[model samples]
Target: MSTMRDVARVAGVSAKTVSRVMNNDRYVSDDVRARVLQAVDELQYVPNVMARSFRSGQDAAIGVAVPAVTGFFGYVVEAVERIARDRGVAMYLTCLGEDPDGEQAAVEALLARNVVGLLLAPVADDQSYLKPWRERTSMVFLDRRPRKLSAAYVVHDDNGGTRLAITHLLDHGHRRIAFAGDSITVPTTARRRTTYELTLFDGGVGMDPFLVSWGAHRVPVVPRLLALPDPPTAIFSANPSCSMPIVRQLHAAGRSEIVVLGFGDFPMADALTPPVSVVEQDPTELGNQAAQRLFRRIDEPDKRLPRQVVLPVTLVRRGCCQRARMGPAA
Candidate 1:
């Protein structure tokens, strides 16, 4: 309940002098600054950030809008928070749960908070609604780029990584390969699926349309993929959510011999029976890069034009994807 006037009274200084000390004005004498700070500590005074922002026409916090608070985006949020802390800026986080309406509401709430910038992994198919705020807020997209906005973005090379995975399987003589992922409407999923088909063509293997499965929920179709007349010798699971289910399905059916190369590396991936190999993209690095770029844009909005960065992905060799071409054991 302590106010600036209380601190000023306790420090025997004018209200303007106390305000100068609180704002770290260089003109305040050392003696006055020390007394004002001591009075602030003794009174447990908390400055109102809203009031400060209103007066200065600036906000010290950045908003982070993500699809969810779990999985790969969870790691991204953690890294963004770490960098924001290191740079002494507040991060206001919101999760949309993969819904377009929720994404719009979350972003509007952040804008209402007077956030200086936005770091978003948007779910909306179109983001043209943000055009009005574009002139006022610095924004940097994460994981996926915005469809209608020309903002800075940081994303993984999903297509290239898919090629790496399929190429590995092809090298291991897996001509009959299956692809599993989320809906093709997702930008990453579409790119990965396209790459999967292109890789098969380049390897001189015929693409099987029946082997590719995608939808809003593709986990249930995993079991069906294995039941086909000509089941795949290997499967390339594109997203993190799709990977674990396929692994479990294979284990449940005692079909662990079938090769699996997942896109995103998960925790305990190395601890599983026939540890899951993966095309690894560092979510932490991706988030850190996004936050750093956002801050740079906030500081030099006009000096630096929008930059889109795509981080590389690598394949991790593990037992699951190491199956060699051979007949079933007698």
Candidate 2:
């Protein structure tokens, strides 16, 4: 069998350099690395990944599945690519089209491809759809997490971000605050809504069940919210996707006083008339970290550490989300 020793000798480099080259780790000079790779190709030396898995396998491929190609989704995929490049791992990119069947097919497709690990932005919060491949692959979730899920995950401090947002509105002297967006079916939406309401209650405001808005999905329901006789003083939309409809309705109704803060960052959120305030999603970092964690899990599947990585995000105030037309400072 061909060996690292033979490659190291042929490339005039040490076996450790061969390993570094194999893993795509840093610290090797480009010239020496090139020679090592050339030697690998010439020797027809395929790394024994399955054997490595059994004893010393080090596969250099990861499968990354995202729900869409929007700004946030694309950012996550880019970050995964970067991390893979840095680590000498190859990334197989899949867009799941943001649905359950699509997400399932993506994971199944990756498993069939013999991908070493998976980094997923799940389409939904159920695993029965993914259980078929769960045992065969290592998976980590991004942006949204699933119920009864066993995989390690990376996500925003969603509840804390919502609390910060609601507190900002309260400080802006908004009494009739409306939580508009998110379906109870989506855990992230439900969690943020609950936190927003709790923050209001904690601040001594009675919860107005009428002021809370929700639906079965993330479709546009802004027109309904705004047309109410007693519309909200300030609005908090949890997703950037939800903000567009909110903005369009407000513009149509000539209701600029209705302040809004979006949860996920988007391109035009800053360019709009009242540059929408946003809680930076930072999915790039999330995907990168989740990939790293999944690789670590692959390397030491029985490692005695339960890993949970949380990235920090800031509430960027712009547009109407800034201090809502500040009153005279007395």
Candidate 3:
């Protein structure tokens, strides 16, 4: 309950001097700073961040918006929280669902709180509505690029990673490979799906529209794909959200013979019966880099133009997707 005025009274210094000392202002003499510190310790004073934000017309907080908090996005949120805590800043997080209207509403709610910056994993196809707020808020896109808004972003190399996964399957002689993932409306999934088709075409494998499943996150598509007259020999899961459920379904159906290559690694991926091969994208690195970029923009808004950073991914082969040829299920 001890305020700056209480510390100033105890330290025999003016409130302004207390404020300067609290802010680590160099103009205050060493002796005066020492007195303020002693009084602060004596009174157990804690700075009111909310009051400070109100007075300065800025929030000492940032916002993070993502599709869901589970799986890969959870790791991203954890990393961003760590960075915010380390920097002595508060974080306000929201889940912006697949709806474009919901995405806009959630983001606008964060902005209404006067958050200094935002780290968004946007699901909306168009973000032109965020144009007006660009001048006042430091925005950084994570995991996916903004559609119409040009802003700083840190994302995985979705194209390269998808190609790597598809090529791995092709090298394993999986000509009939299926692509399972969220809707192509999602920018990341769209990029991955495009790369998946291109890689298959270049590898002399024709695209099978029947094998590609969108909205695999919400619906069980693997079983339907397996029931096809010409079932896929291998399946390329585009993201962890889709990957985990597909793997679970395969396990439940006792279809360990089918090969699977997930785009993002997930928890217990190596513990499954056939395990799981993955094109590993570092969510932690993505979150850390995006949060750092937002902080940089928040601190130095005019230092430079917004830049885009694409992090590389690697293939982590475990148990599945290693077959030399497609054969009858075991």
The better candidate by TM-score, 1 or 2, is: 1
Task: List candidate 2 stretches off by more than 4 Å.
Answer: 1-60, 101-106, 128-135, 215-220, 322-330
Best by TM-score: 3
Ranking by lDDT: 3, 1, 2
- How accurate locally, in lDDT, is each candidate? 0.82, 0.73, 0.85
* Model with the higher TM-score, candidate 2 or 3: 3
288, model 2: CA deviation in Å? 1.3
The clash tally of candidate 1 reads: 0
Q: Over all chains combined, what TM-score does candidate 2 have?
A: 0.77
In candidate 1, how many Å is residue 196 off? 0.9
Give the alpha carbon lDDT tens digit for every residue of 101-208 in model 3.
689888999988888888999988888888999877889999989988887889999999998889888888788899998888888888999999999999998898
lDDT of 2 by residue, 64-164 (tens): 87767767788778877886776656778888774665666567777677777778777666766656666556678777775566667788898989998
Candidate 2: worst 10 consecutive residues by lDDT? Answer: 49-58
In order of appearance, the predictions have TM-scores of: 0.80, 0.77, 0.82
